[model samples]
Target: MASSLLKTYKKFKWLPFGNWLFSKAICKRAPYFATIKPKVTHLSSGRICAEMPNRRAVHNHIGTVHAIAQCNLAELCAGVVTDATVPNHTHRWIPKGMTVQYLKKADSDLKAQAQIPLPREWKDKEDLIVPVEVFNSDGVKVFHADITMYITEKS
Candidate 1:
C-alpha cells in the first residue's frame, strides 16, 4: 500500500499544482497541518521534505516563526516519510514523543527534511526514531527534532 501511494504521488508530483493538491489532501486528514500550509517537496521511501512560509499566522511575538510551528513542520515531514516507508497492512505507527532543539531564530520560510534507513524487515512492534531537521530560507539550520514513533502490527 505504501508503495502504491508513493507511485501515485510520483505520477502527479511533477504536474502543476500537484504539490499543493497533495498537501491539501494531507491537511484534510490532519487538520492542524493546514495551519502551516506545508508544501511537500519530495517524498520517497525513507525520505520526505516539506516547506512552510514564515507568515503572520505562524509568527511569534518577536516576529520570528513560532517554535511550535517549526515543530509541526518537523512532525509532518517525519510522519509522511514514515508512512511511506512502513508497510500499511503489516504495521502502523504513531508519534510517541519528540525532542526538539531551537538552534536559531526562524525569520524566514522554513523547510523540514526527515530521513531514515529503510528497515530490511518489519518487526511486529518497535520504537523507531525519526530525525527531522528544519532550516530557514537562508539554509541556516534553525531547529531539529528527533521524533519517536511507536510501530505496531495491525490487528
Candidate 2:
C-alpha cells in the first residue's frame, strides 16, 4: 500500500533519475499532468512539494503561468501527500472538489507545497481538505488551493 509506496519512493528518490521516473509514472495515470512537467521536490507522511517550470507550454496569453496549470500543480501535490499519508490497506483517496485563489501573476517557475493531517481513522466515506500553496520564483505567493479529497474503504 501507500506505506510500501512511500518506502519505495524514499529509496529511489535519491537515485540519479528517480524523481523524473516517478513523475513520468504519475503522468501515465493523469495525462494532463504531464503538460505541466511537474517535478516532485519533497515528500513525506503529511507533506509534499513540487515545482513546475515557466515554459511556453504552460504560459497564458498574457505571458504568465496559466491559472489551470497552477491548479494542476496544486492538485498533484495534494494528491501525492494524501496518498502517502492515508493508510493504503483500508482507504483510498480521490480529489472531490477544489477552491482556488490566484493571488498574483506567476511569471516564473512555480513551486507548490501541500499538507494534511495524518488520518487516524477512516469512515465509510469522508471528505478531507488538503491545502496547497504555490509560490513564484521570487518566493511570492501566487496561488492557493483548498482541495477536498474523498476517502473511502476499498470494497
lDDT of 2 by residue, 14-64 (tens): 889888777777788789899999988788888888989999999999999
Give per-model TM-scores: 0.94, 0.92
Candidate 2 backbone overlaps, count: 0
* Model 2 error, position 128 (Å): 0.3
lDDT of each: 0.89, 0.89
| Lowest lDDT block of 10, candidate 1 | 1-10
Stretches of candidate 1 exceeding 4 Å from the true structure: 1-4
Choose the strongest candidate by TM-score. 1
RMSD of each: 1.4, 1.6
Error of 2 at 32 (Å): 1.5
Per residue, candidate 1 scores C-alpha lDDT tens digits across 7-80 of 76787698898888888888998999999999998999999989999899999999999988998999999888
Pairs of residues at least 3 apart in sequence or in different chains that clash in candidate 1: none
Prediction 2 global C-alpha lDDT: 0.89
